[model samples]
Target: MDKIIRIGTRSSKLALWQANTVAEQLGHFGHKTEIVKIDSIGDIVLDKPLYELGITGVFTKNLDIALLNGEIDIAVHSFKDVPTKLPEGIVQAAVLKRGDFNDVLVIKEDENFFTKDAAIIATGSLRRKAQWLYRYPHHTITGLRGNVITRLQKLEDNDWDGAIFAAAGLKRLKLLPEKEKHIKLDWMIPAPAQGAVMIAALEKDEDILEACKEINHEETATCVGIERDFLRVLEGGCTAPIGALAMIFDEEIKFKGTLFSPDGKNKMEFYKEVPVNNATDLGEYGANYILERGGKKLMREVHDIEKSTLVYSTKSLSHDQTNNLSSKIGVTSSDFITIRNNRLKRVIVKKPIKNALFTSQNAVEALLNNFSRVELDFENIYCVGRRTKRLIEKKIGKVTHIENNSEKLADYLVKNLDTKEVTFFCGDKRMDDLPTTLLNNYFIVNEVECYQTQLTPRLIEDKYKGILFYSPSGVESYLKENTANEIVAFCIGETTAKKAKDHFKNVVVSKLSTVESVIKSVNDYFQE
Candidate 1:
């Protein structure tokens, strides 16, 4: 091309490296190139996680603006960071050949973090965080944000066990530490388009777009296109913990996609192999298959979890708890926060049961898992929360009664449910008042150990204005790694407030025990 192809990119070191790479590729085509470094909002704000910023395309928005303003002919981006929808008048020009797509665990030499229970792991990606927790629920995940070198420096400066990084980034920058210091996390699925580099040019700039296409890798584009299509169909964008990959194998395309609950305790996955000729709609087909197989409900629950900001619940909230808050308050595209540092200890129950009582979804899941092992003739089922009721109803067809609290459930059972025998599925760490009330009321309660709540506290690297707590156990978990130095405590109810008051002077209690009320309390306190 006769005109100089100005490439716009973020000023970060890694971003400049990516821009230079594209410039080098275009140079081979006898095209003149100019590198323009720009600073994005994502790079400017380092205090909060990217999702909390309430903006999509945090890293590429500035470049998009630059390209539209005619300051640059083309914008280069890490394909994964670019929003699925491009800005007006801008279109994808080319996708360079992809690099290594695995996420690597970088640690100090001879580090014992992985072997230790509840070791601190640092990452800024929700996808990485969710997958890591799903595999190693015993470890705690802390937020790590910065440029490639800055994040590595932070890992060296802090006492954190280890941090995660993209294998492609390290290879591009040639900054991979010793083999002993980094371990390839092959088991974890990578984000869609993770290792690919993308270039965008205005639709009217045919000269630059045509020149860019000369270097486009058709195979790389096809693979990432399918993966991104799957992501778009699922509405994951950049917010949800969704992963998809499409690879051409022996004239066929093999695809794998995964979706996880916000807490990472539950997961759904789908895999398929199809001819490459029919690969255009493979992503969409895979998305629908997973959604039909309980992935739809999991996604809704994840959406609810993402709508809140820094909720520390003792137990994972049910779909109803999260959905109620999402409905009452607006869930922004960029505002989703959940910090679940505890894991549920799975258990087995072999007892015969006629009626089942459940206070949490964890309890209900335990019973559902053991239903096939034992001949359960459950005539009636009583649950304390809407999420538990829905779970049981999906499995057994119906729930006899559902209430907001255990006390209400006990009262309803005493007046309405007349089954002589009952089986209560409960956690090891549970409130004694509900079981005590039932045992004293002449109800033959056969307590079955369902699950145990294990605390895995994370290291708090950044300071927030306030912390939201839903249970006394949540308060206890937060205190394990941090103190209420200047931060306010927003509690779900009086019981949680009492626990927060022991350490924090500025403790505010919500009027009701709901996620919406807790968020309201936070807003009111901050607005003051």
Candidate 2:
């Protein structure tokens, strides 16, 4: 005599597909299965916006109630739709394998679609609305509520130019018409946990839970766990217009995240990949990295503007200094401060400077502050990367040359420099590559100690499942004073990877030098 497992799901075509998928998996374990379709608040209420409802559980409330009342044994939910905090007596039993997590743009084939201004799009989510508005505010987004079939039908009926939907949903339903193509990752990011199904069960149902475990996909579970953790830390809801998607492929896990203003006029995105072994810490680490880098300030400004027009600008000053300057100039500026305090130097210049090279904006700002009085009639100015080039151009009017990295800059100087005389303006603690490489080419490159970047004495006091290191300096600083309690280390670039190996031998190096690569590496490490 086997127990019958009642799978609860929303009464939508897509939800049925998810429910059926779960039931089929359970059936393999010799369990009798049945599906109980229930309508959620999100399904019934069509008139009002999600934010105005002021209630939290529009997507899960109905199914949850049914689960608690014993009408259903388990509830199948789109992982993204589930709230961070679970209700009493319910726990996430398992997560099935994830599908394509990218958002797809279904554009109608019409000659008039070439212009961006007159395009009309359809979407049901505020998250989608915010992102779309951020990127294409001129293109209007009409609310299209219904399951996948109904929404697509409305799009065809109204002759709406296009609609944005989760790639996973369309693929799961097998309803992507031949006329449309899947959107590329460069176009849009998907909702957090968008592709995965979360199985919710009564806390006491150990037997059914054990049976449900057979369907659980370890890689999908790990990646979604990290993505959900990011959403939790951001304090974002379905209406926040924040999107995050994680993928575990090869030996790495990649996380792509975005934040959009409420009206969708402004948006900031970040990507990180690390070994799968560090997937547990990927979300928090990735979120923190984005916040520390620039996303936090962008998010704050977006949140502050609400419906007002936003003007974005960048000035060389500390947050306090910027505030003082803005106040003096009769402009109300939102604090768009990043980790400025950690990575800049204060100095006074006395001698005439000849050659200057900048790797980071912080380095450029610090150099500018020192030479504010002196006219920099340099032989040549070398800048690393596009960001440093912009900073240099803003302050110095123009730059002599730009290279992709410090290594490339060194290579350029080695090939072209006939006279072995160049001074490098740099941080107090910097990589030896630029100097060492130049020296190998018989060029005299003086390394000036401009500023020092040190880690905070108090590291974030959370029990992270893994740790991420962006730079060799960060790794050295972190390891010099503090212990990470046996957390797996995910390193960004080669330098950071070397530093991690020096301390923790089993360091995970990202396939790419970017943040997205580090996140992907973390995903793959954990899945293994």
Q: Top lDDT: which candidate number?
A: 1
Question: How many residue pairs clash (N, CA or C atoms closer than 3 angstroms) in each of the candidate models, in the order given?
Answer: 1, 37
> Candidates' TM-scores?
0.55, 0.54
Indicate the residue-level lDDT of 65 in model 1: 63
Assess the local accuracy of residue 333 in candidate 1 as a C-alpha lDDT between 0 and 100.
14
Candidate 1 Cα misplacement greater than 4 A, ranges = 40-56, 300-528
Instruction: Supply candidate 1's per-residue lDDT for 514.
Output: 62
RMSD of 1: 17.1
Tens digit per residue, CA lDDT, model 2, 70-151: 8889999999889976776688899998877777777666535636567788888888778777766788888989878888
lDDT of each: 0.74, 0.68
What TM-score, to 2 decimals, does candidate 1 have? 0.55
Please provide the root mean square deviation of candidate 2 (C-alpha atoms, Å). Answer: 19.9
